[model samples]
Target: MSGGILEGDRNMGLIRAQLRRQRVLAGMNQDEFGKRTNYSASTVSAVETGTRAMDTPFAARADEVLETGGLFVSLLELARRDGQPRWFRPWLDAERAADQLRCYQPTLVPGLLQTEAYARAVIRCDDKLTDAQVEQRLAARMDRQSILNKDEPPQFVVVLDEIVIRRVDEAFHQALADQVHRLIELAERPNISIHIVPADIAIHVSLTGPFILAKTADGGWVGNLENQLGGIVVDKDDALATLLSRWETVRNEALSRRQSTELMKEVVKSWT
Candidate 1:
């Protein structure tokens, strides 16, 4: 383990090494350390090996279990910005303050609707991403879902191209099934409405890409446009108008809420 700290003490490698040292000095193996921290042995091993990022709760638990005097917590605080890309961070605020959120996904499940296992599989598809990077993004996605679980959640409206459900992760089939099942469950919530655009459509505006718009608590709106590299926050008047127009076009093609729920149920059968 490197003793010298990175400039901001933000390097994840430091977190990994420090955790390993604390475990060893405490005379605990991964399983024992995990038990004390309420995590699995595999999770401990992953963090130590730089395969999984250390989240705040785990860091706080480690401080208690390892008696590090909150050192681990401090380190994670400095490195917290790495949890999500800078470009996408602004959107998270918009999501949390939203009165209503509308989204269109042509390729896969929306982040708010993903299960942990399913989120992992989708995130790992990026060959260039390290396991640690994958876990960081996955954690951010999971955290983003909390907005929906709030006491007064935003009304979340999602429109998916039929292929989103039809395309399943073969290697993680069961997780994919669980994800579809989750969508069905979420559809039952009063504040959530999910619609699916059938596959037979020849050509539609949704084929262009995916975008999300949130009507904030202040009665203003913000939109997001994502692509291969990163995403842009859409707030300019003309841009938002264009984006809203596009969303309406794609949403118009979707099956009604009742029909969509039945469609999702039918899709789950294929997965089984």
Candidate 2:
């Protein structure tokens, strides 16, 4: 439990260290601590070792278990803001608070729908990322999917370019197959819908990168555009309007839900 297991992510490091110390002082191993918190030992180990991002619910549970009176919760709030690069925080907040998320991805599945292995394969594309950084991000991405399973989760309308499902990478072959199955499972939920833009689509307007428009509680929209570098949050009226236009165009190009699922099933067989 020392020397940058999480690669000197001090904010995360401090959280993990403190949690570990508390469990030790209470004479509880990870399995014992996990039982008190109603989680598994593996989950406890992941959090304590910084391989998993400690989520808010777990923080609350920890506070209750260790009688820390919300100390873990407070620390987690800071970790949430500072754990990742500064630029991504605003949209992360917006996404968490959004009631409706409209997503369009041209090359991959949206983060909200990606399976754990699929997310890991995608994040590994960045060679510069350390193992700790990748695990941190991968955990965060998996945690983000929880929003869709919450009580009365948001209405998620996702449109993906056909290649997202059709394109196969030799390295990600198995992960991609599992991802398609995950997509189908999630789409079965009433709140989730997946649409696919067929390969025949020759439109260039939607080629301007993938973007998501989230309708916040205040009835305004926030946009997140992803690229090779990072993501940008869109809030200005004019910029949001342009995103709206682009979203509408690609969404129109997408097949209906049933048709898209059928197409995905056809592509899944190709994996074998």
Identify the candidate with maximal lDDT.
2
How well is each residue in 132-216 modelled by candidate 1, as lDDT tens digits? 5677667657767878989999999999988877775567678878888999999999999999998887689768889999998
Residue-pair clashes, model 1: 0
TM-score of each: 0.80, 0.85
lDDT for position 232 in model 2: 85
Per-model RMSD to reference: 4.7, 3.9
Top-scoring candidate (TM-score): 2
The 0-to-1 C-alpha lDDT of every candidate, in the order given, reads 0.82, 0.84
lDDT of 2 at 154: 85
Write the residue-wise lDDT of candidate 2 on 8-126 in tens digits. Answer: 37878888999999989989998989999999999999888867767778999999999999999888766655665566778888888889999988888998898889888888887
Model 1: which residue pairs collide? none
After superposition, which runs of candidate 1 have C-alpha atoms over 4 Å from their true positions? 1-35, 40-49, 63-80, 169-172
